[model samples]
Target: MSEVITGGCLCGAVRYRCTAAPNNVGLCQCERCQRQSGSAFLMATVFARDAVEFERGELKVFAAFDDDGQGLYRHFCPTCGSAVMITLDRYPEIRSIMGGTLDDKSWLKPTYSLWTSSGQPWLVLPPGIRLHPDYPDGAVA
Candidate 1:
């Protein structure tokens, strides 16, 4: 088994653990993500839903559709308002942990990026990473 990945909200109000190895680390630069994250983009590390465990606190969720008209849900800590994870319609079995909330983000390296067309022009994406104009088919592993 891979080493566990753990994280939480900024205020320590919420925490989570991932038993499975995290893969498909990437960013979403869509308008909704930008607005919700209050940042240039949303960085995330993907894992299977069953592999993740909510170790503490309940998350408040906001449901919406992505720019591609796919169902999306954002889970965040109600107290600190820090986004913890997201569920995408394309891969209901997968859950994405917010990169910023990870306790050990030093090892975080995004290998692909979603919604490249909607990405900020000023932000330069690294070369060699897979760039998808929109959601890639079967994006989750």
Candidate 2:
């Protein structure tokens, strides 16, 4: 079992706790991730949906579709505009937390890259790290 990880949004409008370790922590090079994160890619940490819980405010969700046109929920704090969490329809059992929103991002690092083939030009991922042409193995657990 992984240690419990706790974090909240920029303005504390959204708070969350995870009782188990993330199944995956990685960068997403998909176009939607780039656009939503406003960066080269989105740094995300995946956990079981059942392992996460909100302590206070609720997240406002904006549903997005992946390249395959599948639903992906982008969750954020309506009051702070901070990107907090996500849930992909393609991988229903997983919940991904935006790593940047963590109080201490020092411990969070991508173990791999997702959607590398769709990655933006000029975005160079770390050498030798696993790059999933699509979703990585065990992303939903």
Candidate 3:
């Protein structure tokens, strides 16, 4: 990726710029993701922690405990309650941004699907990508 990726919260209270290309792109089918996003799944792209820049405003972070009892921070705009990004304690170097907030997402390609065990039965994922029953093999479980 030659250019930086830009995004922000719904209320425009927070904005971000990512200089480094995303390390991971995928959809998560975990229940927590669905509950937090109020959707069927979480569509996100992960990048190095330092690659993300909060160019406009501050974000409110909610510490949510995962099924494994690990704490993860869900960062969002307090004004709109729009989830912007996330950081897991186990993966401090990685920050996952909500894809829906991206200013340009014409090149997104989800290479994996996480938590397939909890995915909706009607959801048919593409055949080539890795699909995990619970968590991916190298995932912090």
Q: Who wins the TM-score comparison?
A: 3
Better of 1 and 3 by TM-score: 3
If scored against the real structure, what TM-score would every candidate get?
0.91, 0.85, 0.92
Pairs that collide, model 1: none
lDDT of 3 by residue, 20-89 (tens): 8998798989998888899878887998989999999889888988678988888889899999998988
Error of 3 at 139 (Å): 3.3
Residues 1-141 of candidate 2: C-alpha lDDT, one tens digit per residue: 237788899898788888887787888888788888888888888888898888989888999674789888899899988889888878888899988876667677677888888887887767766888877665541
Clashing pairs in 3: none
Candidate 2 has an lDDT of 0.82
> Residue-wise lDDT of candidate 1 within 4-93, one digit each (tens)?
888899999898898988767998887778898998789988988898898889999999975689878899999999999998787888
Clashes per candidate, residues 3 or more apart or on different chains? 0, 0, 0
**Residue 58 miss distance in model 3 (angstroms):** 1.9
Report the alpha-carbon TM-score of model 1 versus the true structure. Answer: 0.91
Q: After superposition, how far is residue 2 of candidate 2 from its true place, in Å?
A: 8.8
lDDT of model 1 at position 109: 86
Alpha carbon RMSD to native, model 1: 2.2
Candidate 1, poorest ten consecutive residues by summed lDDT: 132-141
Query: 125 in model 2: Cα distance from truth in Å?
Result: 2.4
